[model samples]
Target: METDSPTIPKRTLADLLFILFLRLVAVSCFWFGLQYWAMLVGYSLVGAGRFDLLSLPWKVASTSLAVLFPVASLGLWLTVSWGPVIWVLAAGGQVLMYGLLPDIFGPNKLIILLHLMVAAVYCIFRLLLWLEKRRHRRQVSVDLP
Candidate 1:
């Protein structure tokens, strides 16, 4: 397909690196928030004397998964071909975490809805990037001839 629309250049390696750094910082902040929430939940459970009944290991594992998500997300975002897979995984994880909230006494429909909304936005961002890449490739091929 031949189109005359101007295409933006794909980011340079240096730009990608800078973006990766920023993503890491953002993800770190996210992890911190998750940890804070986990601590709050843990303390509450302890205060209620339900800590023995609740699985501490499961809670820890959940927190670890939450921390792992941002690192994976940053790596995938930095790699052009893997961005979609990472986004899907991240979104699915968010949904699964939200689903688990009932067990933790954190099942709030509003929170789950908000997570879904964020997932939708993340998907939209990926779609825009894919379109931009396609446009850039097409422009490069046209310029060759």
Candidate 2:
């Protein structure tokens, strides 16, 4: 039976670097998740009398994201399609939260912008590889009799 799925093109150096970037992002996602979780736990256990999100809606919203990011990290590590979607969502949520409630969540606007810039750079590199591959394919087709 003919397969509906097309064969994947051979991996190149650029593809490998892209995969490495994804893996690095995955690891960073895991770290960020853990960092948020640790803060929640620390607030609850150590700083209970001083401050915590327990009294605010941020508690629930941030808690939800604290759970989401690491799970997304797994998909990112595997380089699945859903990974980027979830990662972007988590990152956006963090940025919005921190931007609006800087007192509670410590991340500054600059940090979030920097994170996005890094992703933008990765995307630009990936686009160049894709365009190069397409150009090569067109040249090969044109040369064939």
Candidate 3:
């Protein structure tokens, strides 16, 4: 029985790698979220970083991130479409906080750099996957009568 819908493509090595990367990122997001919570709850080693003592901007930034990162982690761990969107929002928030508003958030060059690198790698992997899919489709069409 022929159907109009195209056959679902089997998962490839690239797909596996992408999923692995997503899971790794999810773990990192979880860790980052935990750290924010620790600071907010006075569990962190630095007493000065506690939420009650934090400045207004820091309070806002920390609270938002404390919520966002773990939610992002859950979505990412599931490997759903919204996962990356949430991750981007969470990461971009930090980028803006530390990269642009350094005076308020302080300079976290390492984190900003890490986010940029992860973004670049994600783009590259997506491009490669797209190209591989396109090539597979072309080959499949050529093989048909």
> Each model's C-alpha lDDT?
0.54, 0.76, 0.92
Q: What is the C-alpha RMSD of each candidate to the true structure, in Å?
A: 7.5, 4.5, 3.2
Model 2, range 84-140, lDDT digits (tens) per residue?
888888887877777776777665878588668857966887698889799869987
Report the lDDT tens digits of candidate 1 across residue range 36-95. Answer: 345535654454423344467445545555555555556554555454455456545545
- Residue 88 CA error for candidate 3 (Å)? 0.8
Q: Tell me each candidate's TM-score.
A: 0.50, 0.77, 0.91
Largest lDDT belongs to which candidate? Answer: 3
TM-score: model 3 vs. ground truth: 0.91
- What are the per-model numbers of colliding residue pairs? 0, 0, 0
Candidate 1 deviant stretches above 4 angstroms: 1-29, 32-94, 97-106
lDDT (10s digit) by residue, model 3, range 1-145: 5544467557889999999999999999999999999999888966777988999998999999999999999998999988889899999999999999998888999999999998998898899999999999899899999
Q: Best by TM-score, which number?
A: 3
Q: Give the TM-score of candidate 1.
A: 0.50
